[model samples]
Target: MEQSLYPVEFLHFGIHLKFELTETGIFLKICVVNFSVLGLFFHRPLALNLKAQPGENVTLSCQAPDGVDIEWSRTDLEELQYVFLYRDGHIDSDYQHQSFKNRVELKDKEMKNGNLSVILKNVKEEDSGTYECRFKAAGEGRRKRAFIKTKPISTIQLEVADPDPGELSGCRLNLNSLTGFYFMLEADPEQTLCVD
Candidate 1:
């Protein structure tokens, strides 16, 4: 197998990219990144999938250091829309979104075995959104925890929907309407019938 640079360049939002083409696949390279704005594209989280029906309990799963606190947030909502927050060994509701005030909880209060999953009780359609779980590990020999950086542990795409309501027109669209056919019924005169 051989690989060579494609001789192409891409400069978007101050970040330059060079793509390399190979016999088997294409590889992308990030040449530069802008510091003025948040580099979100370069720091995406690990994605997970979850599905649940409305009115059912949903779990946005994540796991990290056993003792570190975790925060659950939704990206589709406004910035800093903390879906659920746990810090300093307890749940913090100060900045939690109003709608999630009483509907969210930690699956394991102690985060045993590094389980940082959250439980959303009685989920609604509105709950369907992208969720991110982050954790901040404290520095060694530090007696206090600080918000230095919240590294993402996982990103979950939650889908809260009700079962499909069966199609009920009390009649079927035979779909034979487009094509007309002439047929004889009981040896009678030929008649054209198109079922719609």
Candidate 2:
């Protein structure tokens, strides 16, 4: 009796795959060689960069090998804002910022695809703080911080209250009332009097 068989093999970067065929069935084997170069060629997802203006819009993005879930929050706060969670190819609406209620929104709602930018309108000074973007995958996640800068309101001297005659000593002072009170200026150096 004569028997016939076929053998197959595949090789790539120290990874070897072999298949053996016999009369009854086929057997397969896969062998991986421990090599340092293989690790360098693999691609891995990294944290994304997020930033925004005090009263403007911003986005926090992340890229991962698989689907991702994002959560945004501040370091000082104990709770986290779920933001727009992208999972199962849809965004969950249960989580949203009350402060941003209707004024803010996320672009490319599919957070799993790496577009997690947030839009905010009429940003306030209190909103100028560090915001964190966290990405979750397979129960593991990473965090990145975003900074917001707000413009400070210009300070104007509203009024210079009238001081007692004893308070006016050696220096000459000018006063302006923000309430539109027109004070009379007297040149008398004897006593400081309030005139309006």
Candidate 3:
């Protein structure tokens, strides 16, 4: 009598296992595999659109569950660049991009509450781009050398524009009436207001 069982693959908790049965004997193989199946449980990145005037400051907010590792990066660049990184309860600046070196600040104390917002000072036209805020669980096993769980939790699209003389006149204008209006009121009104 001869019988063969087709190879079967099983995946659990980021681990992968394979089993095969042949007439001679049963064979088993186990290997670590990085799979996109892990992404099923993670929340999709939230999209935010923001605008700032040149030389102003802007804050990008990213909300995550407490105790998770957070990483902020600029995704619209030619090369992926880290704007800021927070892991294991502390900020890691070694990987921060040179452009963001002195311009980015994180709300470290609010991290305990699952807030990982960053402030970008002296916003300029060059700062306009897509920014990604990612998060990973803190206790991913150190033994796994190839798997990474970092997933984007937020995506911010920032636009920096030169202040318009008439628009900055402190008049209460309806945003609904103005098509494509993007600036948010979070900076010093005096500095943002344009004097003719």
TM-score versus the correct structure, for each prediction: 0.56, 0.36, 0.59
RMSD of each: 19.9, 20.0, 12.9
Clashing pairs in 1: none
Candidates 2 and 3: which is better by lDDT? 3
Count residue pairs with overlapping backbones in model 2.
4
Which stretches in model 1 have alpha-carbon errors above 4 Å? 1-46, 138-148, 166-196
Model 1: weakest 10-residue lDDT segment is 1-10
User: Any runs in candidate 2 off by more than 4 Å, and if so which?
Assistant: 1-54, 80-89, 93-95, 110-113, 138-196
Flag clash pairs in model 3. Answer: none
On the 0 to 100 scale, the lDDT of residue 90 in model 3 is 74
Ranking by lDDT: 3, 1, 2
lDDT of 3 by residue, 1-196 (tens): 2222211122335657787898988788666766432322334457899988788889898876666666788876444347887766677677577888888888656675778898999999999999888766655443322222354667899999975654543333335454544444423444553222
Whole-model alpha-carbon lDDT for candidate 3: 0.67
- What local lDDT score does residue 65 receive in model 2, on the 0 to 100 scale? 32
TM-score of 3: 0.59
lDDT of 3 at 44: 47
Tens-digit lDDT string for candidate 1 (1-196) = 2221211112225667898998989888557765432222222345788877778888888866555556788887665558987776788787788889999998987788878899999999999888888765422232232321454668889998865544221222343455754332222124233332
